[model samples]
Target: MATSESGSDQTSSALSDSFRTPYYCEENVYFLCKKLSASGTAAADGSDLFVVFISNEKKQTPLWNQKASKRADGVVLWDYHAICVQRKKEGDTPLLVWDLDSSLPYPSPLTSYVSETFQPSFQLFSEYQRFYRIVHAPIFLRYFASDRRHMKDSAGNWTAEPPKYEPIVAEDGAVHNLNEYNEIHAADVMTNAGDFLNAVFTQRLGAVINENQLEEFFLKMP
Candidate 1:
């Protein structure tokens, strides 16, 4: 088990060191879910693991306390970001978020991760407002494929080096289906909270919810 010190600046180095990768949050999270599921920290079938993608129609979501930021406030404007959320079914463990890019503690409690990272109290322009796509880890793992094409410029040069490992391909042999998971539309926002909760676990792409509903959405998860 990865142990964390209360109020530590970051999660135990061991966990982060094992999973951290630069500019590949989605892939980093894919393997993190695998670790949690295989290690038995999550449910044996991995139902306890969820992938929460944060972004907006503009792909201009601003998040704070990200390790990638050089600013004193540790803020970074991301096109999209991904994190692993663990909601164990066993004894009352708080919902935990594993963000490899965050300066916040590794596997931070969902509440703290939301309050500090999302800063819902802080107002933002409509274009900068954040949206979340919550996908079950099992479904995400099986279907999430990324060719890393988005990282390239029009010139086809590598904007950032990709992982040395081969790109992820879905079990069904789909390549470059990343947009299916990263893209969120304003029209798709679930108006009924009850319907959103139920759809999140059942749908392959999961459900899209706005920033205000983020913490509450996960808190209400089974």
Candidate 2:
């Protein structure tokens, strides 16, 4: 577990170290939590980081009500949104939830966000019922970084050729070939300013109504 001084600016350092994403919340938060867990476990005392993945299935959640592009099926999918939860074993710092979807505060306190999102007379975890899913961090890390599919080589090149995949045998005696999962995971390390700009902004993303031509167009935004 990481230590922190309450009300200090130090806690925000973790947020700064979190890698940028192409507005892909699922991949972004997964990678961020993995990085934080690895870094936070190196304490002098033998304490490990605790991170949680919160999934919302209720239609009333903020994600389900977002104004952005949603699925055409008129149903807010569970995998559509995800947030990283971290509880520090330090001071009185509240549990932090990282939802980088632009609509919610980047690093929001868990309770505060829950209060805002849940029903008016909600109890912490009791009222959630079947609408919430919680998975321990370590177990999730197993499935997350199991392969180097989206990663690069030592010389800064694509790790492997396309159609790169792993083989798996299904329960029904069927063999399935799974492609390199992260082949298109938002361009691992942003190539250039243009790449960064294009990855983040869509036509109507934040206040900019038009698609940007280049990085300069984004920099000049009010």
- Per-model TM-score, in order, reads 0.91, 0.42
Q: Worst lDDT window (10 residues) for model 2?
A: 203-212
Candidate 2 Cα RMSD after full superposition onto the native fold (Å): 18.5
Please report the TM-score between candidate 1 and the true structure: 0.91
Alpha carbon deviation, residue 176, candidate 1 (Å): 1.0
- Most accurate candidate by TM-score: 1
lDDT of 1 by residue, 79-159 (tens): 999998887555444688889898886777788888889887888988898888999898898888999998899999988
What is the Cα-based lDDT of residue 159 in candidate 2?
43
- lDDT for every model? 0.82, 0.37
lDDT of 2 at 209: 15
Checking candidate 2 for backbone clashes, the offending pairs are: none
